[model samples]
Target chain A: MQLQAEEYELQFSILVKRLGSWLSGQTGVAKAYVTLRDSQLLFLVVTKSTKYDSDFEDALSDLDIELANDPDLRDITLSVLSIPNVPSDSLSSFMHPTTNFEIQRGGNDG
Target chain B: MAETTVKDRLRLVERNHDALVALIEDARNPHDEWVATIAFYKAIQLVEALLAKRHGSVSTSHFRRLERLRVHHKDIYKQFRPLYNASMVARYLCLPDEPGSTSVAYFSSFSDYIGDAKAAIINGRLIQLEALVEKGLGEPFTKTRV
Candidate 1:
């Protein structure tokens, strides 16, 4: 069966919501939101507690659910196979998002 | 800290386009190392995030590469589908919680942004590679001519 990019994206989106919520519930992430960018999908599982990142991933693994990249399932699996740049502490998490407010990368839109 | 100029970024994009394509190929291939595969997706996400930050969105050719990859390798990339859309995932790590704070709140937040930026760049490169592969060299390119 051939699936279009958006089709894959839709399935992936549903999965993230189901899996992210499940993971959040298990890990105590009160408000977990899932977002899909093009075909790439991401689960922004938020919580009042900072340590929930690790727990969320762990819970996802525990459930044996993995994030998918539209058609690149293996790559998607690989993306999740490792520990993302999750913050271990507040201090480290503080420096997580770089201040690229006005600064742009590549410097070109075209 | 790219350690290079705009010209260098372009060169790097051109020189390494093939590698990025291959990375996605390997990532989509299940026979490859599981750990490496995940890293490839992570890396792509990082570059895409970066490119998106700079350009508001990835280019036409870049988006095409995404289409081709998705068409050929659905299962492999399925695990990272959310990161592709990545609306909320990035926010988990980045984004300012407080309204008025100029600086990001946490170190990890910065890390996520930088890492994601890298992913955006790499992901964007996938399309550039496709252009190079489909079209002959020395052709008129969108970002730069080959």
Candidate 2:
């Protein structure tokens, strides 16, 4: 059950996607994007509204425990951030393929 | 606003690096958690600036930014992962019931607590990242543009 670094990353990515989809099905959640950096788990959960209801907190608590039990993700810090749901158009734009652009002022343009 | 060029991102990298140095010094004086908080952000901003130079765009989402680095520049990603983890812990993971007040006792036992040596290491990584970005930018723009 020893996983290499790449293996861990791949497994975690799949796990995050599945978890996100499931979380989105819940009452308050609209969409979810999960990331594990250095094995620390962070869920960027898009919510139907800004306020976090009790049901949402309960679900997040359960999700946290579930992620902790996974062999590959155990012992890592787990947290969630709730953000307003994004428009479909904007999400689609974000998914578009990246294009090369001329570097403009303040290479920090991003 | 016009698009940011590699030159602009390079300048940002330098600015964040300078800020990080100052924060490290400030942290030594009062051991304030806010110092670590600002330092963490500076570290992230510095790395993002370097990534913008390479990819021609940088992600706004922290995770996405790291993912891009992992995909395109594994070497840089490896160096950055720990810094990101430390910063996350400093900012989001460990906290007191009160706002703006950090419990030193709580922080001492926090799993991802960033010690002085770790802070130094993060600074060192920023230096390396800056050098790498500058070298990459030195190449012909047409060849590096992607």
Candidate 3:
């Protein structure tokens, strides 16, 4: 069944919160920012890992699969970013400060 | 880091593509991980060339490049995502089991692991991506050798 607009929005919010909490618990994830752009949900993840690092890529692939498997998120155009690849200043113009997820104490050893 | 020109990126595309072709044709060993990794880099260069042509600059990071593709070139993004994931698996997760251990006991089945078949699949995807990028750029990729 197709979700109504309001119901979809509610689901999106819940999913974002759940994803944020889940990401906080992941290894190498420091902070994550959520934002909507061009009708796509973007997660800007800050990590100590460099681009193309094996563990980082593994985590990303896993996340991609997880999102794809979720019925609520399957149809949504979603993109996850590892922040090192994108400068924070460049993203700040579009990503609001309030969207930052609450990060845990010690998981940034990528 | 200095910004690379479209010409430079395309040159890199050719270099990586030729290297991929050479690796695939080697008779001694399949070199699955190297094949997959090279194919991914070839795809990256193709996307970077397109990005340079369209946006006047290439992305400095992999995710940023992916974001550009996702936002501006959805078709390419669809093709590129699988290539990226496959390369990740080939490079990181695909490991040889103990001498007497069954492959089924590991993270992946033997047939599903990064082997000749998976490398071929990655190569096919890279070719498809190359065609798409060439169409978008209105230029044929120069292949020194196939």
lDDT of 2 by residue, B23-75 (tens): 55663454434444544555465555556665667786765675566556655
Ranking by lDDT: 3, 2, 1
Report per-candidate DockQ. Answer: 0.06, 0.03, 0.05
Find the candidate with the highest lDDT and give its number: 3
Off by over 4 Å in 2: A1-110, B1-3, B27-39, B95-112, B117-120, B139-146
Worst 10 residues of 3 chain B by lDDT: B102-111
Best candidate, TM-score: 3
- Model 1 iRMS (Å) reads 9.7
Candidate 1: residue B131 Cα off by (Å): 38
What tens-digit string does per-residue lDDT give for candidate 3 at B1-146?
22457778888888987888788789797776677778888888889888888788889776567757766786676567757755654554423333244322233322344344433445445666777888888656864233
RMSD of 3: 12.4
Q: If ranked by DockQ, best first, what sequence of candidates would result? A: 1, 3, 2
Number of backbone-clashing residue pairs for each candidate, in the order shown: 76, 7, 0
lDDT of 3 by residue, A3-76 (tens): 57887776666566556666756776645766754445666665543233434544664565456456666445
Error of 2 at B42 (Å): 3.7
